[model samples]
Structure formats: C-alpha cells, structure tokens
Target: MSPEPQATLELQRTLVLVLDLCGTFAFAVSGATAAVRRHLDIFGVLVVSFAASTFGGISRDVLIGATPPAAIEDWRYLAVAIAAGVVTFFWSPLVERLRNPVRLLDAVGLAFFAVAGTEKALAFGLSPLMAALMGMLTGIGGGMARDVLLADVPVVLRADLYAVAALVGAGIVVGGHLLGLPVVATAVAGGLACFALRLLALRRGWRLPVAGGAPPPDGDA
Candidate 1:
C-alpha cells in the first residue's frame, strides 16, 4: 500500500481499538448501574458489567466464525470491563445521581460498538448489508444479555429508535467505506450518526409507530 493509504489503515486500526475499549467501559457502566438498581451483590454487578460490555462483541465474533471470541482471547477487554464495574460499584451513589445515567452511557456504547462491529465485519470480508446487520447486533447484544440476566425486558426491543440508530450508524460506515473514505473518518461519521439520533430521541420522545390499534406504552412506564 502507498504511504498515505498505509497511514490511514494504521489510523483506522488505532481508532477502532480505542473506540472498542471506550464502548466496553460505557457498557460496563450501564450494566453496573442496572445491577446496583436491582441491589445485586458486587459480584453480580461485575458479572453483569462483563456480560454487558463483552457479550455483544462475542456474539458478533462467533457469528462471523472468529473463534474463541476477542472478549475471551484478549485480557484487556476483561480488565476494562472489570475496572468499569469496580468504579461504578464504589461510586453507585454518584452515578445514580446523574440523570438517566444508564441510558446515556448505553447510548454512547451503542454508537461506538456499531462502528466497531461494522468495521470488523468489513475487515472479515462480509458484504456491506451483512456487515451493517452485524454492527446492529454488536450494538445491542450486550444490553439484551444484561436485561435478560436481570429478568427485565430488553431495552433494544422497547426503546425508541435504539436498533434503528445502530442500523443508521452502520449504514453510514458502510456507505463511507464504499465511497473510499478513510476508516477513521467513516467511524466518526457513523458514531456521530448513532449518538446524535439516540440523544435526539431521548430528548424529543421520538419513536417508531407501534402495532396498529394498540396504543404504544410510555417509555418511562
């Protein structure tokens, strides 16, 4: 590869790694918060954190035939999740003080994971459409697992535009990649797309219309 292209590739790799770790941390926080709300013990909190942060990546890797899963192969991923859980555990009161902390953190994680997943799928030679779906799965899988563990309905199933935001973010990355945009540029664009849409939905109560003749339940209900 030419020097410019090589540099871009390196930049993309670095950005993906950074964003992946950040997403892990964000998801860990979300999980830990949920555990705390449920009055789970510290161990349970950490377990939830690890599951929420890594299971999504694990699911993506497994589906793509990446054996052993990066979450289990790489020690850093576990460490990040544990660290996030420990921090959140000790600072539960502070975190609870924040307005809608779990949702906000989950939104950040969702955006980053969507970009990371799409990039990884593309790297694994998947077509753009499949890669986008992988991205959406990576964005929501962990939260689904966390909710299941807690015996609560998954947020992705009920939240306004949750999966839609993930899909849009992945689409942006795929579209940008096809247009020959740098990986870092595409990731930034995609992450911003997901993040902005999530925050906007939260702020303005934006939601997809539900099944006909049945009034949609309130999100906060």
Candidate 2:
C-alpha cells in the first residue's frame, strides 16, 4: 500500500479506537448508575459496568470471527470501564442528579458504538446491509445485557427510537462508505445523527406504533 493510503488506514483505526473507548466509558457510567440505583455493592456495580461497556463490542467481534475480541484483548477497554464504574459508584448522588442521566449516557454510547461497529464490519468484508445490522446490534446489545442483569426490560426494546436511531446511524456510515466519502467525516456525521435522533425521540415522545391499542402504562410490550 502507498504511504498516503497507509496513513489514512491508520487514522481510521485511531478514530475507531477512540469511538469504541468513548462508548465504553459512557455505557459503563450508565450501567454503574443503574447498579447504584439498585443498591448493588461495589463489585456488582463494576460487573454491570463492564457488561454494559463491552458486551456489544464483544458480540460484534465474535459474530465477525474476530476471536479474542478487542474488549478482552485490550487492557484499555477494561481500565476505562472500571474507571467509569468507580467514578459513578463514588459519585452516585451527582450522577443521579442529572436529568435522565442514564438515557443521556446511553445515547452517547449508542452513537459511538453504532458507527464503530459498522466501520469494523465493513472492513471485515461484510455486506453493507449486514454491516448496518451488526452496527445496530453493537449499539443495543450492551444495554440488553445490562438490563437483563438488572432484571429489567431492555431499553432498546421499548425506549423511543432506540434501535431505530442506531440503524439510521449505521445506515449513514454504510451509505457514506459506498459513496466513497471520507471515513472520519462519515463517522462524525453518523454519530451526531444517531445522538440527535435519540435525544429528539426522547424529548418529543416519539415511538414506534404499539400493538393492541396504546402502549402499556410502563411502555413495555
């Protein structure tokens, strides 16, 4: 490969790594907050944080045949997750005081994870459609795991436009790649789109249509 192409690839990889780590931290904080709300001990809080931060990435890597997933192989991912968990555990009152902090952090994580996953899937030679789906999975899988551990419904299954936001973001990344756009530009655009859509959905009470008349009182199926 030429020097310029090699440099671009390196930059792309750097961007992906940054996105993944940022998403991990955001999700970890959200998970820790949930654990604190549930009155879990420090160890339980760390467990939940690690699960929420790394489950999606691990699942994506496994499906793509990237054995020894980055989360497991990379010490940075674990360190970031544990740091976020400890911070949240020690500062529960401040974290909880933020208006709907969990959802806010989740949106940040969803944006980053969706874009990063799509990029990795595409690099691994997956079809654009499959890459997009994988990206959505990468965005929502951690939240599902976190909720399961907490004995609650997954936010992706019920939250306003949760999975839809991820899909849209992933689609944007794939679309940009197919169009020969710049990788960094596409990633930022996709992440911002996903984050904005999620927040907008939450603010405007947007939701998919419900079955059997209105949605249940608690927004479950």
Candidate 3:
C-alpha cells in the first residue's frame, strides 16, 4: 500500500484500540449489572462480564482478518473489562438499581464501536455494505452474546433502535468516505450519528418497520 494509505491504516488501528477499551469497559459493566441483578456467583459474574464485553469484538476481528483479536492481544482490553466486572461485583447494589447508567454506558460503547468498526473496515478497503454490517456487529454483537448468555431474546431482535443506530453511524462513515472526506471527520460524524440515533430511540421509542405490514397496535389499521 502507499505510504498515505499505510498511515491511515495505522491510525485506524490505533483508534480501534482506544475505542475498544472504552467499549469493553462499558460492556463489562452492562454484563456485571445483569449478573448482579440475577444474584450470580462472583466467578460466574466475572466470566460472563468478561465474555460479554470482548467476544463481539473478537468475533468481528476474526471474521475481518484480525486473528485472535486485540481483545486477546496485549491483555489491556480484557484487563479493563475484568477490572470493571470485579469492581461492579463489589458495587452490585448501586449498579443494579441504576438502570439509566447501564443504558448510558452501553450507548457509549455502541456509538464508539460502531464508528471504529466501520472506519477499520473502510481502512481495509472493504465494500461499504460490508463495512456497515461489520460496524453493526461490533456495536451489537457483544450485547447479543450477553443476552444469549442470560437466556433472553437478543436486544437486536427487539423493537429498539440499537442496531439501527449502529447502522446509521456506519452509513455516515461509508458515505463520508465515498465523498472523500477525511478519516477523523468521518469517524466523528458517524459516531455522533449513532449516539444521536440511540438517544432518540430511547427517548421516542423508534423501531424498525415490521414485516408483513403488521398493523399498528394503536387501532390505526
């Protein structure tokens, strides 16, 4: 690759690490909160928390060519998640009672990871559609894994904006790239799009249109 392209790739990798750490921590907190709510044992909580936060990123990386993934590389990603889990284990009561904080932090993780994943895919010269899909995976994969662990329906399958927000964020990044926008600017715009969409979904209960033209539940059919 050209030097410019190489530099951009490096920058993308660095940003992925930074954002991954934040996302990992946030995911861990979410899992820990769940475990605490269920009154799980300490060992189970730690394992679930660590796995919930990192498995998605690991899965994304492995699919896109990063074998073993950064989550398993350098140790910091897992460390942060594990630490957060351990901390939350001791602070179970506080984390469990505060639903807003869990949602807020999970949103934070989703926004950053979506942008980071999309940017990384673009950096690797992937197609826009694939890039967006990867971004959504990065944002929601962990939570899906988390839900599966807890034996609940995946959040992405629910009537919520989680996956939609990730897709919008990634779409912005892909569009900006197609227009030759700078990487950082594209990432910022994409991340903001995800954040805004998530917050809006939370505030207004936005959901993806249903299949088969399901009639509105408000008697508007």
Give me the displacement of residue 200 in model 2, in angstroms: 0.6
- Residues 3-90 of candidate 1 have per-residue lDDT tens digits of 3466776776677778889899999998898998999999999999999999889999999998898889989999999999999899
lDDT of 2 by residue, 1-221 (tens): 12337777788788889999999999999889889999999999999999999999999999999989999999999999999999999989988887487678779999999999999998888999999999999999888999999999886786579999999999999999888888889999999999999999999999897677787687644
Best-performing candidate as measured by lDDT: 2
Over 4 Å off, model 1: 1-7, 100-102, 214-221
Q: Which rank order by TM-score, best down to worst?
A: 2, 1, 3
Model 3 misplaced stretches (Cα beyond 4 Å): 1-6, 211-221
Stretches of candidate 2 exceeding 4 Å from the true structure: 1-4, 100-102, 219-221
Cα TM-score per model: 0.91, 0.94, 0.89
Model 2 TM-score is 0.94
Instruction: List model 3 lDDT by residue over 1-221, tens digit each.
Output: 22447777778778877988888899899988887777789988888788788877777788889776778876898789889999899987787777787888888899888988887777667898998999888888888888888888776886688988999998998888788777778888888889888988998978778777765765234
- Span of ten consecutive residues with least summed lDDT in model 3: 212-221
